[model samples]
Target: MAWIFALTIDPVAADSADADFADTFAVIDPAAPALSVGELSTQRGDGIFESIGVVDGHAQEVTAHLERLAHSARICDLPAPHLGQWRQAVEMAAAASGPGESVIKLILSRGVEHGPAPTAWVTVATASDFTAVRRDGIRVVTLDRGYALDVPARAPWLLLGAKTLSYAVNMAAIREAKRRGADDAIFTTSDGFVLEAPTASLILRRGDTFVTPAPNGGILHGTTQLSLFAHLEQRGYATAYETVPVADLSTADAAWLVSSVRLAAPITAVDRAAMPVDAELTASINEYLLSPRD
Candidate 1:
């Protein structure tokens, strides 16, 4: 899901590789350092991918991850790859995977336009450490350029709802945020309607109400975001799906960027202003995730 090169790695399993990937696509060694995306495979056509966390040798909610991939792919109009092949590849990579935590990414591509069949696959590796995300929280930089949210779902025209391989804008936004001394970026319409974050689902707390952008926000439907909100209702947290103004978040009790990877990254700073995470809200979320559900 993320590729900012790699740092230190601590392995606890026999299958752990030397670094993350000596110089390949996946992580064989977390310490080998990051090579340029020049190595990113281009032989495949555009497709979708899923980032999954494997715990206790079991991939948590794998079906949900796969379902999301399928949804994204279908909307993007990208060629769908065989799920069985992807399963095998992920398992092989996991077998050779490092210890501790591993991020299993399933990347499906149509393969270089050599033929009709799309080439797709999955890669596994030790996920990079997000000490910054875990500690300092997220800094959201609003970008001027924002695409309009296509009201009615257009599975064909509006591939924006899908997680396509063509993420030039998404990646650039994050890079631009860092350049502005912010942790991440979120897009806003020229008219100033706040949209989703580059890599997460936008969320905010107004008074006691936990609110997130409506599905019509036209952003990728995040499983983690949906899961968190679904759990909130059962745990006594009030949540609603609605349109949120960019400025409204500045005065909100708490703001968050949710995703499978970040889980719920607090928006500590927005373009310089700060809004710390609500301690009580954080506790409630942790309790929900750690506790079992029916």
Candidate 2:
């Protein structure tokens, strides 16, 4: 089952001190038509979005996701999202979720051409059971992302750092990975630096230290990764953000791809080369992820 809500927003009044949000949204029938054919999100993928993991009706890492949404808006030049209104929408979506795992997505799109404001909505739906992949782990292959590590610094207009609606390349990379006999793909810069997985963030574990690629290199900062790092740190594990070289992947003691909905999936193999997996640690990490979190 799924639920959708169309948000009523006034772009010009986005930052107004007296902006009203009491009736800012309305529930919509998922099967019925809600968006226009001229919507930029569908036509040109001109927008930004964030997916929040929901466990037992509780939306996790909402603050982090909202922050990223605003960041994307600034990058895309879309109207700044009213965080308070979006938070209410999240609460409403979470309330509609079942007791099991689910996903809540928030989308703010460039509305119809020459339209007054942007198009925004929230959707809640049941998530697929990822027990097997999360437990047994996934096979991964590295793919070049066709840009140097300095692309974000050099080409800000590419919108590489923003979590925009444009995902053709991302989906194609995953398809290419599958064709190469792998479950997923980890993107690497043309200069041979590790970036991130198509839909997840990469975390490499070396001894007791945990490292993820720095977000400065056009990486969408992972909310789950941040939360897990906090959990790991509280448990006495050192964490750092650094520019990870592709060669470092093979030498890592362990690795996992972390994301919002999928949580943490240990990488069993990269480029068909076997990587170590710590089952006990993976289970513990997933346990913490499955719990209700703010």
Candidate 3:
């Protein structure tokens, strides 16, 4: 399906009647062209963004995503975001997105050259179909991130934990995985510890305990994974955060990639080596992820 990029910069100017606006809607457009050629986000990838899963016209974990975005901005030394403005914009787009599954993106960057404030926008678009992959599972391969697990501690300037817009390396890793006939890529440290996927967190099931790499291991603290763990713990399942090695992927009882948009997708194979998995457990976790907390 063709994607509609509806560029509107001012939240107050959202036009709900446009023909190409069904799948995508923008709540803000500042300039006549939306974005300028000199935007730092375009020129230097100097921005932070959050992708939220929208179901039934409600954004899942909006507060969590916004908190992460703020953290990313602080790490990048960008100005603080106007939370009120962002929330309003997101709500506007979400309301116009209809009662279907959609993806909401909150993007903020250092303002365009000579501009006074930050450049921010909220976009709502149709989410991709993940039924087959979510049900059947995926094949994955490990790739070296070329950074030690402790690099984030020693080099804060690297922004290892920040979800900046500079995702070229992450995209390249996934491409290399596809080139090798795999569905996704998991990044391993220079010393051979599992980090995370390009766009999701890794969850390894060892018997009853759910093990995920610590954020200190150079990965994002995934909101979806945290929520799932909370649900599991409330229901008497064990959880842990520790250093996980790539070899563990081969011996784990089950594994999954959890994120906001994809939720919990089982990993059937790692490095072309088939791994044992519990389909019932996978489905149960997915159900919890999709369940309403309130």
Better by TM-score, candidate 3 or 2: 2
Q: Judged by lDDT against the true structure, how good is candidate 1?
A: 0.63
Best by lDDT: 2
- State TM-scores per candidate: 0.76, 0.96, 0.89
List clashing residue pairs in candidate 2. Answer: none
CA RMSD of all predictions: 8.0, 1.6, 5.7
Give the C-alpha lDDT of model 2.
Answer: 0.90
Q: List per-prediction Cα lDDT, in the order shown.
A: 0.63, 0.90, 0.79
lDDT of 1 by residue, 211-254 (tens): 88776756677777777877777767798887777778688888
lDDT tens readout by residue for model 2, 124-204: 888889999899999999999999999999999999889999999999999999999999999999999999999999999
RMSD of 1: 8.0
**Sorted by lDDT, highest first, which candidate order results?**
2, 3, 1
- Give stretches of model 2 more than 4 Å off: 1-12, 18-20
| Residue-level lDDT tens digits of model 3 in 1-294 | 112233344322122333233233343432236678989888989888898887777777777887888788889987766554556556676676666567878787776887776777766678888877778998999999998888999999998988899999989999999999999999999998999999999999888899999899658889898888988899888999999988888889889999987888899889989987778888888777666532
